[model samples]
Target: MLKPWFALCALFLTLGAIAEPSPRQMALFNNNCVQCHLRPGVGAPLVGKAQDWQTRKAQGEDALLRHVVEGLKGMPPLGYCSACSEADFRALIRFMAGMPAGTGQ
Candidate 1:
């Protein structure tokens, strides 16, 4: 009966909920990193600038996590992602690390 429809809707909703980061993490990035790392391209743009992050990643994920959590030159602690959890930062790094440095601004 309608059970299939309900189940389908529930599945979609659950998937959607798990697909993205929390609003707090979003907000933090928006307020902080969004400036330097523009959405499509403008500022430094972290999404696809693999080169930009490659040097950092070379140090290893732990090093990158420490930099993000502790802060670095030109970047404040959490990179302004104040509310981001350690796990959130890790995921964010992994996502950014995958980007190719040559990605257009």
Candidate 2:
């Protein structure tokens, strides 16, 4: 029983580790998202504003990704980060939407 419990704990720990973003991802977010998301009335949802992101989150991750990739409203295509990959977009969206990493999609 103890062996099984330890295995479960290890698995959970590994999963948690994998859920975090890399340093490059952090840089990408700081360089790109912070410019608009941290401000008000920029047409981008302010980071950490649950109410602002709630409606958008309800639209699902796929729809959000599409909007980001194609540009929606005042947001630019690829969210202005041409180097950002799909995973990067997902991580940034989760961060901005106030969802825990790996919880989006």
lDDT of 1 by residue, 7-105 (tens): 435533644432344456555655666566543444343544556766766887778789777877766788877667776776556555652222221
What's the CA RMSD for each of the models?
A: 11.5, 11.0
Clashing pairs in 1: 50-100, 50-101, 51-101
Q: How big is the positional error of residue 19 in model 2, measured in Å on the Cα after superposition?
A: 7.1
lDDT of each: 0.57, 0.73
Best by TM-score: 2
Write the residue-wise lDDT of candidate 2 on 1-105 in tens digits: 254335435533644543455679767876776677766878788766668989998998889889999998799898789889999998877666756666644
TM of each candidate vs. truth: 0.58, 0.75
